[model samples]
Target chain A: MKHAAPTRTLLALYTAMVAFVLIAPTVVVIPLSFTDKASLTFPPSGWSTRWYENFFNDPAWTAAFGNSLTVALIVTVVATAAGTAAAVGVSKWSRKRMAKAAQMFLLAPIVVPSIILAIGVYAIFLRLQLLGTLPGFVLAHSVLAVPFVLVSVSAALAGFDDRLTTAAASLGADRWTTFRRVMLPLILPGVVSGALFAFVTSFDEVVLSIFIKSPYLETLPVKMYASVTRDTDPTIAAAATMIMLLTTVIIAVGLLSMRRKKIA
Target chain B: MPDKTPGAGTRIDVKNVTKRYAKSTAVDDVSLSIEPGEFITLLGPSGSGKTTTLNLIAGFTELTHGSIEIDGQRVDHVPAHKRGLGVVFQHYALFPHMTVAENIAFPLQQRKTPKAAQAALVASVLQTVGLAGYQDRFPKELSGGQQQRVAFARAMVFNPRALLMDEPLGALDKNLREKLQLEIKRIHQDVGRTFVFVTHDQEEALILSDRIAIFNNGRIEQVGTSADLYERPASLFVARFMGESTVFKAQVSSNGSDWHMDFHGSTLHGPVTSTVPGKGALVLRPEQLRVAESRADAPAGSAAVPVQVIQNIYLGSGHKYELRLPDGSTGIVRTPLTERTSLRPGDSAYVHWPAHQGVLLEDNDLVSTT
Candidate 1:
């Protein structure tokens, strides 16, 4: 499988080009966030942490950050529990065609256009008087995040041996006990990765958040969108940098847990 | 080990239990009454209802008809977890996440046994399976044989009344399988619990089971001690399944004294055993047949068939002759080295056996199709 020297060099160069394309935006934002000038200008003449201070000092920005965290956390919990249960149920379904249909239905939110989903949710929330409410945000974000959880959890369950469940039952474990003692612990890596995915999905969501947001209850992404139109402050870049850092850490943690499970 | 009195095992009665799927019957009206403290093996090939019957007793599969009773109480409606039966699977379904001690202690913990007592029981069961000092090792850390020993320890740790094993030694090499077979037999003797085992390997069944039930096509062909099945098989299927046999399709008739079998073009005589005989199969075990130089050299009053020696195999302890019969079927004959005749390959010979030893069974398509 060893490549020729020229081919190896070409492959390394191609990989580096792809990596640069993916990382170029994050590199620009990180440096732009530390610019001394109020305006976002990458490769700045002077460097400072003024935008970072501004991000922490302004109540609007801080409130939006807090709101995003709250919504993402709630969405992670709700979506992970619901999605994990759905995955387990689908896996245990005797009729495979029905199970596949159910799975495709659960995954429909991911495939359907976000704007279409946002408009539908907004209409439902307005009638229920839940528009711009925390519950409304949570419900909408959970809908977007659940499919991520389902995909990860299903991947984990795919590797699980059904005979272990049978073995647990034969060892005097009831259904719930078997789940708690054997199935849960075995599939915990998948659940953890799914939770991480749910958090990132909710945090990074913008199109749905924009449609549903009230001025008083804006998420960080909504605030950043609004800020981009009204001003050119580097503070938006700071927020973007932090979001990148948070998601990168979460994804890295998810991958590490998955790798550990593989090694075990 | 303390010299404790053997615990009285539970009796399991499978009363005409049948399990039918949408298109086929997995287990046809099969009934077996297992005595307390008995080591009974359900022996058959794959797809033959033996494993289904084991699952029925384990309460894993619901019976479509009839009922199962354990200790005289009907348990057909009970779930597997509540049936209190230990099952050892063919692949050794030990929990990879748990240590040896933790795996063995799982059932004890389910029963809410005291922590100290659970540890003692795990240790004792591990010792019983000969894995005493490997408490903290995970299943994947052990070899297949060692993992199966751990599985056995886990299944028996809770002292279930009866243990069900479905080819527990099937995943091991032949040497390890034989070793574990002896270990399981000794464990059964020490614990005195009823054992219901399932295996396609007839030799393993013969070595370990006090009684063996032969299954074919979702039915129990015969249930008997190994000797009973070997010496007196009830059907052609049972006779062929139990051991290596040379079968001759024959026409059976009685002469008011002895039964005669017209095999191919030769007449072979035996005692009258079955009265309703028309077409029959004469089955002769390898050890029962001897290769002689000629018809006159065959033992007196023995039935003989003319055959050509195709190959002579030296088996260290005995000599085996591959024979080509007149009907284009192959026959085998095994003789002790002390009784080895000066027979060579390509030599014409007479394969002879005592008339009483040749079992004449009813011939039917049931034996040929499967």
Candidate 2:
């Protein structure tokens, strides 16, 4: 292909740079997850599933994974419900200035620095006697997930016709019935995507969980982090590989579901 | 018919209602009383407050200044769902989740009606809206026109005390709009329910309204029948708004109990008015002007305006003549297609009106610039 000088140079430079930056680390790590040796050294002298077996076989690793799953699920449920409800309330009051303020408040979880939220959550959880408890972590994560839910559901609610509720009200239906029968179904796809985001956020979170939870109630990220800090091993690499796999699947599913809704 | 029996008339009485939103007055001091079985259309341009009037009657907005009485009982504080007034919006606004049957059954369900009776009512209302076989279909599966029928069914299912339509046909294409207009008229006739419709389209208002309330700026400019507004408009706005007309300045003088207007350097005697006698202008509808061969001793058709035909526009039904007089003030003369025997560009002709055809207005021509 004949190429202009700048375009050809940029394309070549971007391709090589992307390959070095993205593929290099991933290529070095995947094989390490299956290393027979205990050390995290690349170009391993042997190959086996010993690290994977150990990660699944050890009660501590499995328990931490289970705890992470539980926290993510609870956060997803609470965030999706509260965030979708907020979306509907704001949609009905869409054109008003107050609705705009409520929307900004909902998205403040994303806009404000995570450190501030972590500090606030830590302080509140301590007073509530919920420090180091699973509920406290889940609630804090759900607050982080709400902005995602609000954004997704708010996008869906943008195209919602306000007159639909008026039409329902003019008929025999009350406000609650109108929301249940009319608004919920239309906004379900966005809510599901938001819920998936909630799941992913809490599942993969490294901060807040690091500060708030105890050593006994360590999430998968905290456990893997603690293991890496104390010593470098192929087991930590194995856990990292699994977490990446789970997150990739969740993100892919959320994107596909949203796309399917749009097409339909 | 309602006037013939006591306690039957005056289905809706709106007494000096007003709605104000910070720094903007949406509806102001509006008052209208709709008789039972009457079709009163509030007609005006956008933001003229007709839609606000309908919303007030439907209990959509809280009235700031006045009370709304339905059947002589105050409904000013009633919530929209409890007002018991059926409403059809501009958009079809069909519930996306529900099937046609479910949407229609909603109102019945809200009232705690029995299940079997609710089904029967939903079926009957669907039939009334001409959606008999589409009961199981969801709103998204139907066309725009079908969705509108479902909206109609949903609105009328509860047998509301009155009906309010806010430009219900505003979204449809022209053919569908005209078709639905007829269907709405038929439904109104069959039900004989008082319908207060709000629309800015004057032709739609004229065709559907028993009497129209023409609104402007936040108040009712005039309220009259279609013929009344077309034939004898009260003000310049009403006269010009109702239909096409060609108006001219005339200096009038009284001659032997007959008022004559001086036009084109000639005296033309026409209808005598009880108002001021000095000077004013005469307004003529384009259709009311005629070309007469004889303008002799008959003082009624005096001062025939000698004009050169500039252009003739052929409307499908008739011919519209763009004629220029000696003065530069432009006006149009409408003639039927069958009578275009000698009329064309650059033809000499005299345009005159019968005495009764002209309506006299004060010669305040400066205020009539638009």
The best candidate by lDDT is 1
Candidate 1 C-alpha lDDT tens digits along B194-237:
99999999999999999999999999999999999998888888
lDDT of 2 by residue, B1-370 (tens): 0022322323998898888887878778888878888989999899988898888888777777889999889989877888888898888777777788888887788888799988888888777778898999988899888888888877777777777889988888889889888998988877778888889899999889899998877788778999988877766567777888776666777655677776777555665655744556667788887653334523564447766778778898887887676554656778787766466787766676666567766665465333
Model 1 stretches with alpha carbons more than 4 Å out: A1-7, A42-46, A257-264, B1-4, B254-258, B299-301, B312-319, B336-340, B366-370
TM-scores, all candidates, are: 0.94, 0.84
lDDT of 2 by residue, A1-264 (tens): 899999999999999998899878866777888888889877888899999999999998999999999999999999999999898888778378999998998899888988888888888888897877888888888888999999999988888887777777776567788787777787788888889988998898877788788866889998888899997878988998898888888889878977877786
Enumerate the candidates' DockQ scores in order: 0.74, 0.55
Interface RMSD of each: 0.6, 1.4
Off by over 4 Å in 2: A1-20, A23-30, A43-53, A88-105, A111-113, B1-10, B112-115, B138-141, B249-281, B286-288, B293-350, B353-357, B361-370
Error of 1 at B301 (Å): 4.3
TM-score of chain A by itself in each prediction? 0.97, 0.88
Model 1 per-residue lDDT tens digits across residues A1-264: 899999999999999999999989778999899999978776888999999999999999999999999999999999999999999999999999999999999999999999999999989888998878999999999999999999989999999998998999899999999998899888989899999999999998999999889977989999999999999789999999999999998899779878977786
The CAPRI classification for model 1 reads as medium
Q: What is the lDDT of residue B109 in candidate 2?
A: 82
Name the top TM-score candidate: 1
